[model samples]
Target: MKILQDFELLFQQELHKLYDNDEIKAIFLVVIAEKLGLNTANYQLSKKDPVDDKNSAEILSILRDLKKHKPIQYILNKADFYGEVFQVNESVLIPRQETEELVDLIIKNHKFSQNLNIIDIGTGSGCIPITLSKHLTNARVTTIDISKEAIKTAQENANILKTAVQFINADIFEWEYIFSNQHYHIIVSNPPYITPGEKKYMNENVLAYEPELALFIEESTPLIFYDVISSFALKHLAPDGDLYFEINQYLGAEMKDLMIKKGFEQVKLIKDINGADRIIHAKKAW
Candidate 1:
């Protein structure tokens, strides 16, 4: 067994080869804080505290998994988004900061306290809809995903967060069949937009650990989900309803054009924190 300080140093040294020094330091802080159930300052103050043999072994084992490129969120089974923590696993893509920006944009643009009907098409971990439901207390939020496991995980997160969100397991490609008459005041999706060819540009941690079902599109059908979801929005969105998407950073213009062609007015592409084109907002004119 080793002291918390020594374990942290060991984790940092072992992970530095896989991540930048700063990232390694951040990971150490997060992991240590999680293990000790304290914040960074508190963890720092407790660094000299000795860890039991079992706990130390578990920490080292987690480090080994990190070295294997597994995501820290998967190892921890939780991810933070919009100031709330949600359970996550391999069944769902980890919630990301850029997606939080999308959710923030929606909240800022909409009357959250109104009884708006919102549906998220690819609800992973229920982050988007759960956060929206929590903040927009009067709004009716519903989310659907193709994967049953993903929906199960999302429902669990919603329950844990004590947010009421209707979760459905249905593929967006065939969404019309089941929800033909359903209309939403707001429709959102952060569907799979990364082309398979973009795999080379991704970190091994993501490519190996994250679900490809939620990550990739065929190179030839780069805009497949965008095209499909935009079409679905055209038919199902209420008059002047809004549609939002977390889009491929590389295809912002293409997404805008696609929305425009679908007769959505005021189509706009927004950049995320990194200044990468990441989100699309559009309104149904009819």
Candidate 2:
């Protein structure tokens, strides 16, 4: 393919062939410009000249990566979630809009306390834990992830954002420590809830590029993470403490039912911007 003379025209034409979403395409173009050391804000501010030869070569390379179904966020090595930017790569699942809804629900409903303890399980990129730490000034956040690479990335993000989030590299399934007298006021997770049957439906960008350990659960035990996290909450959550999750839309009712069966009070399934059942919020019985 011939490299077009104009950057904007070239971006629009190249991305149109790959992504169906115009907004995503526009965002990708900005990412491409940013990667090329071009001031994206200035590029937008001024109808700038065409990208120079060096940048044109860079754009061509990025376009090829995008064509291979790599997510633009991964291409840019960053994504914005919950009013904060997080560095992301193939090691972790990209933060999604639905997870933002889960965070918003927790922030909106819970009353902040100076000594509130918050734990975020499966803290990919530390988006949830860091966001919570940022909003709840008095809260001390702890985040756990099994992947060493993911934990490293999350820790880097916490440092970059100047957020004090304690990160633990541990598998929740094998974690056997007890809090004893210590209790968390909030426990939140956006765990791997996608079932085996659904894996076939995911696009190559997700199935091929994203971490499988952060995306899939066995069909026989689709609620594996939920069950483990809920068990932990039952034992560790403070009386009347809240537990929140970003659930699989297809299993919203099942998640609510599990919480109810576990003796949680005020169990509620919440919808995201797309009106899909995406979040579940419940409080431990006092």
Candidate 3:
């Protein structure tokens, strides 16, 4: 393992125990490229590049953590969302590609206009609002999270992304009381929609490392956030305001019906790249 190329075989062997051969290779390649400051193309060209004793030990240590099911994003403390990098830790859920689809959906459907107000509920990592602020330049964006730590992390990410997103540290359930005057032209959330019963189906890394508060809900009321937020929109959203959600894959029809019952119009459920129901788009038809 003294040579960088020499570690490849051993790393793949270790990762193969937990991941498919393709994924193991992909992960190893990414880690090596990042650690060695080589692009994938260059790394493939320099497979024989040597690793010093210190660097070899560091690589092995990281591999050990990976073997224990630590998420690679947490290992690097960064995730790419919507063509931008967001800082993430265990306090917040790592921004996923599906969530990027959620963001893209909003960006595609809504044209950013002057004074457009947007608020994101449960702003984990602030990825949604921050990205919206970055691209929706004239939109005044604010994001709320129940966890102060998550708010702080979101603030840091906002700063890094050079986006002016107001980070509010209050439970969304209490938002009506705390910021009753606040209303929005757009409201979005990628809230905790996973049911407690579904924990058995989650990945080892997600269950072991990601914050549970940002992941799960009571099995009896898996759509608690959606119910509350969509209802809130009935009173708070401006005329023709849009409401977006990254929903549980299992709840598309339920979400559409919920929004419609709450009086939202044009309620649409969208599938992710995998064709699983993952996003819902609806509007207040004032």
Candidate No. with top lDDT: 1
For each candidate in the order shown, give its overall lDDT on alpha carbons.
0.88, 0.83, 0.86
Best of the two (1, 2) by lDDT: 1
Model 3, 119-175: lDDT tens digits are 899999998998888877588998899999899999998888788888889887777
Question: Any runs in candidate 2 off by more than 4 Å, and if so which?
Answer: 1-5, 36-48, 178-181
- Candidate 1: lDDT of 226? 84
| Residue 241 lDDT, candidate 2, scale 0-100 | 88
TM-score of each: 0.96, 0.91, 0.96
Q: Candidate 1, which segments miss by more than 4 Å at Cα?
A: none
Which stretches of candidate 3 lie above 4 Å from their native place? none
